[model samples]
Target: MMILRLALAAVISAYAAAQPASTSSSLVTYIFGDSLTEVGNNNYLQYSLARADFPYYGIDFSGGKTTGRFTNGRTIGDIISTKLGIPSPPPYLSLSQNDDAYLSGINYASGGAGILNETGIYFIQRLTFDDQINCFKKTKEVIRAKIGDRAASKHVNDAMYFIGLGSNDYVNNFLQPFMADGQQYTHDEFVELLSSTLHNQLTTIYKLGARKGLR
Candidate 1:
């Protein structure tokens, strides 16, 4: 019986030793989209229309400080991070000081951002999808430099890429103008545009080595 117990202890030790060290480090999560994902960039935009800084915005979040997340509490990205075993990404604008921590994936989502280039109805600081993509590319480069090619590749390929958009394109471009100028595109035209834009964005991310993308 003693010999059997010793063998069991040996087996347990071997199994524990085989487990990888806990690195606290994890793959980077890149959240890209509109107000839904905008954690704080709007505060620097010099525009009040797209800002979400006030009571009741982050009422359900930790400390109840308005982090500029549009939702009443944690945004979808935050929920995804909790599921993926990593910290919620920081906003891109807040990374101006070259903090390597922010480079571990940043939120390029602007509050009034849209899929179309000319869709920011009344806001001058709104970002278009093209602009968001450009910022994403820049963030990728920074991640590559700081985390090395392999880690960066793993970070991107394995990381969760959350994209929440299209609603703004509909709100700011289609519905608003339809109400104002009575300008109407058939429903088909609107759907086609949205689909094509989404496809292009996903294709771009796939090319960037994104294997685990979400919408």
Candidate 2:
């Protein structure tokens, strides 16, 4: 999968690469990825060990309050949103009961997640890339309910998408001796699998109404 930083450079010309439509106040962003793009998704995963809730994790953020970002400050996602002049979207789980944040978009990234479903199994409760996409789909349904179908469709089609994945598939799965992928496939085969899966994943988002592909 394409890292969020790489996606940033490719999708936008400058101003931190999350360029909102010139006619709109702010472009809604649908974020998907691993820790590098995760804001606070993992913190709400009850069984998740991939959380970044510790104080040191947000020592550099506003008021020094940890918001589940893995970094000591804002993440690539946060920076992108700031550049676009909007609040960073909140975690997907955090939206289950909140409707006021829909216009801000939703973040489905999870720490330790990867393109492959099994990539972060050791994290015990991380959302794989597939899981994140599913959450986005559910998010779309909620958006439709909030607004009429036509407006919701337009909203989704006009939104920006950011995806960052794959690092964990290399660091947490393919490189781990005990992982099934490492035991069953050669390096070349593993890469092919990743590419193939990601292609389908991207297609799904497009079919669901996203005009741009981030990964």
Candidate 3:
């Protein structure tokens, strides 16, 4: 499964690489997902129950210090960005709005977050798909302020947006006997809800200026 996921991520990176040079250089990368794509957004959440800032989490990373990535080293997001010849965007929570790094887009994923806001409720704190998208909106505002509306619009449209989500909604929410979703709806109904919710969220991103996306 890990190998498969890496292969798919590579496809997106390759597509980005194949983009015309004029647009490629201006392309920023944004990531959203659960542990598989999470870098360090959860580390900055004061009360976040899902965290990876401890020993063994990043033993393979440089300096052997944990950076909130769930993997032993870099997450798929890190690998994809490095392949694209750009630094992986930093966690949105880790940067001040005025920081120059804000121009490079942001990673808004949380380790336990899911498409449905209630999916990770037991974790006490996780950024749902809604929360991550909201952060992106704020990110756009910051970029607009720095480069003006027209330029920012163009930059955002040129950016690469990646999302790895949904599995958790089933693994951690719908199938969890302790959760009400399982009791409230049949499996088919739940699946439909998940699909529609994801479609709507992706549409929201498209309307917000994201033109190239991979999931």
Candidate 4:
């Protein structure tokens, strides 16, 4: 875990440094991933074991208080948002359909979430990639209600999306000996499954008005 954190940190720093400066303001940014990018969505899950709402998780963040970020400091998504001069989008659970916060963006990442619904079953509860998309669908409805269809469509299309999924599907699912998926699939088969599922998910996002994003 420590090694992964260091490697990701280095990558974030490198990416931040490589980007040219821009005067354009940030658009709404949708974030997706596992614990690596989760802000506080898991905190809202009552029976979830993948929670990180206790001490030391957000020790290095503002006010030295836990914020359910799953790490002692800001996540990669947070770091990138900071570098981009944008407010890190809040957890999806922290907002409401009637809230004005949707205009900024939302983070639907969960601590044990993955591309597949069964990927983190051991964690008791975690949003899958499909679940996150459903949350976005609600967000779309809210935005559309607020600004009407045409403006909301433009808002969604213009927003930037960042996806950082897949890790949990391996570490918490297929790689676990007790899990059925490992026995059911050869590695090649598993890869194909993931690829196909990801393709469908991306297609859904496109149809939902996602014109640009990173995965």
Q: Which candidate is the best by TM-score?
A: 3
Q: What is the overall TM-score of model 3 with all chains considered together?
A: 0.92
Model 1 segments beyond 4 Å from truth? 1-25, 147-151, 178-184
Model 2 is weakest, by summed lDDT over 10 consecutive residues, at 15-24
Write model 1 residue lDDT over 1-215, tens digit each, in one string: 23533453355345335535463245566777888678887787776478878988999998888888887899766765654556778888778545876546778788888777667657778666778787777777887887798887777776656676776776777778544322656768877877897789878878887786544
Q: Which digits, one per residue and each the tens of the lDDT, describe model 4 over residues 63-100?
A: 78999898899988898788666789999999867888
Backbone clash pairs for candidate 2 read none
Sorted on TM-score, best first, the list reads 3, 2, 4, 1
Write the residue-wise lDDT of candidate 2 on 31-130 in tens digits: 8889988988888889898999986899999889888899999888888777767678888888754476876688899999988999889889998999
List lDDT for all candidates, in order.
0.71, 0.83, 0.86, 0.86
Tens digits of lDDT, candidate 3, 1-215 = 24546667878877867867675556688888889888899888889889999999999987799999998899888888877767888898999978988787689989888889999788888889999999999999999999999999998898888888777787889889999998999989998888899899999999999997765
The TM-score values for the models, in the order shown, are 0.78, 0.91, 0.92, 0.90
Model 2's TM-score against the true structure? 0.91
What is candidate 4's CA lDDT for residue 155? 94
